[model samples]
Target: MAQTDLVPAARAPVLAAERLAVDGQYLTFSLQGEIFGLEILRVREIIGYTQPTEIPLMPAFVHGVINLRGSVVPVIDLAQRLGRGATELKARTCIVIVEVDAADSAQPMGILVDAVDSVLDIGADAIEPAPAFGSGMRAQFIRGMARREQGFIVLLEVGHVFALDELAALARGVETAEAQA
Candidate 1:
């Protein structure tokens, strides 16, 4: 599918933030050799690798639900959701549990990642506007790029990544693909 079909516009508002106002602590992690960061405020907890129950009629990226302390939380394969293939399961692979703004409520979700990096306090000056094109990701996927000594860590807007509306669209895409197959 084309990139636009993947980056649903319904999710854009989730991570939309101004460069100057985007400064905050972020939790960084790796996905397909790329470093990405999520606003620390959105992260609820980090847990060890575990398989989640697969759901029918859902996108492959929707790895399915896991019982978290009694509550069922949906886990998303962050790599696949971003257009990269599903993450290769490994010792370092783990889930980053996050809470995203869903309409008026805060919905909890899990983000599967290759490995957990570290939490960093990124200043406003360190943030640069997302490039218009050729970032290997949609402009909305990135909140901003944080300048680092090694390079730039793409700051991901977690809410947009897990927006209910966008995810529903992605699920529909999966169904379409399966039907064609």
Candidate 2:
């Protein structure tokens, strides 16, 4: 089967208020020896790492864009985005296509990971609220911490990770200024 076909078609169920309140299933992946997860709902597809045509003046984390079915989607390196050491693109590296919802629009974005892990069915009971201190990552970027058989998985807030609002606003502002010029 094709990679697109392997992507989960149906989204997992949202937790009810009465339930433990975890978001949904997560597609766990590794980066710099740490395990991190992204909400499976936002995941569109996963493809092996391929060199992307570099674009200038963008953020350091922005690895450039790729052509998926003719739609250009920007890719961000999760390792660099998380402030971890830079990752050497290898055979195991893969790009995870995520759909981030911007404040003004709903558009999908892609994130590159060192390696894609397994899909974990973590429920509310298994999750603990993110710690305020001692987490190397910014608190805003984290959703929660999940306990797993191997160890702990840092659940990432995919929307916040890309800071879609800030990026979209910046893009809009540039357009507006260009129009005014």
Candidate 3:
């Protein structure tokens, strides 16, 4: 199927809220060695590693685009994007398909994760504002820190992680690369 045929279906579910409580359930996953979470509602699906079609002139962090059914979804290495080095693909590694709400539309993107952990119900009492320092990833990408077990899981702000400006630049890069090719 053509990509335009797939765009609407891909963006529809990402904006709906499925939770009823003030506390949010987060789908946690590992990047490098640290754990991170995305509000469960933001995630669309998880697929095993599939090499994406390389798009030239794109950022080092961008793994390139994937033909998800029919839609061309950009896949990003979460670790590399955050300057933590590239993620080593393993049998357990998966591309987390997420719907990131953008200024013009709800954009569908893929985030490569080392491994997916269990979903945790982190209530408001257990969630704290992101610390100014010490967190491994950029502060802007972090939504908050959830206290769990003996440590913290950085909650990712999906919208910021897959910001439109960054993606638009990547799209431009694709065009530039194609032109030069």
Candidate 4:
């Protein structure tokens, strides 16, 4: 029997490879009291909370830069970026380093979260379209909502959440102003 013999010809339509990639393991974490998830593959590492060197003119959510093995990496406060408010750093607070896509390359950035949660394997069937409201954050930042036993975990589209171009522009502005000072 051929592979097509398993399914009805009418129901054997294929989907794009990219579309199928959405369902996979996610690294879940908490922001405020709500749970959120990021694709595990993007995560580089998690480190203990360290005060970042504040960069003048950067946005409030941009917690400034940290030296990771001699490389300066900008840390973003996810709570404030999501409009929830600043994250009150506690014992469990840590930075989740993720590789976000830039214009022509991937840049490593840090996202500060309340605490790291467990990894979850969410299937496409368990995912739902982002709702129009009540997500707390902007709808565009959400990839989808993954239904879990506890509740729905807002799966973030990291590229949208951390737009490198916008950040780069702000950095350029700061650099220009500093040079003339």
List the candidates' TM-scores in order.
0.84, 0.79, 0.80, 0.82
- TM-score, candidate 1, is 0.84
True lDDT of residue 10, candidate 3: 76
Error of 3 at 5 (Å): 45
Worst 10 residues of 4 by lDDT: 11-20
Q: What does the lDDT read for residue 166 in candidate 4?
A: 76
In order of TM-score, best first, we have: 1, 4, 3, 2
- Distance from true position, residue 180, model 2, in Å? 21
lDDT of 2 by residue, 22-120 (tens): 657899998888999988988989998878777765666778888888888898878877787677787899999988887677676778888998997
Tally clashing residue pairs in candidate 1: 0
lDDT string for model 3 (36-65, tens) is 999999999999999999877778888989
Model 1: per-residue lDDT, tens digit, 1-181?
A: 6434546565454334443366689999998898999989899999998889998879878999999999899999998888889999999999999998888888889999999999999998888878888887766678888999998999987766788889988789878888998
Candidate 2 residue runs with Cα over 4 Å from true position: 1-20, 103-105, 168-181
**Model 1: C-alpha RMSD to truth?**
7.0
Alpha-carbon RMSD to native, per candidate: 7.0, 10.3, 10.3, 6.8
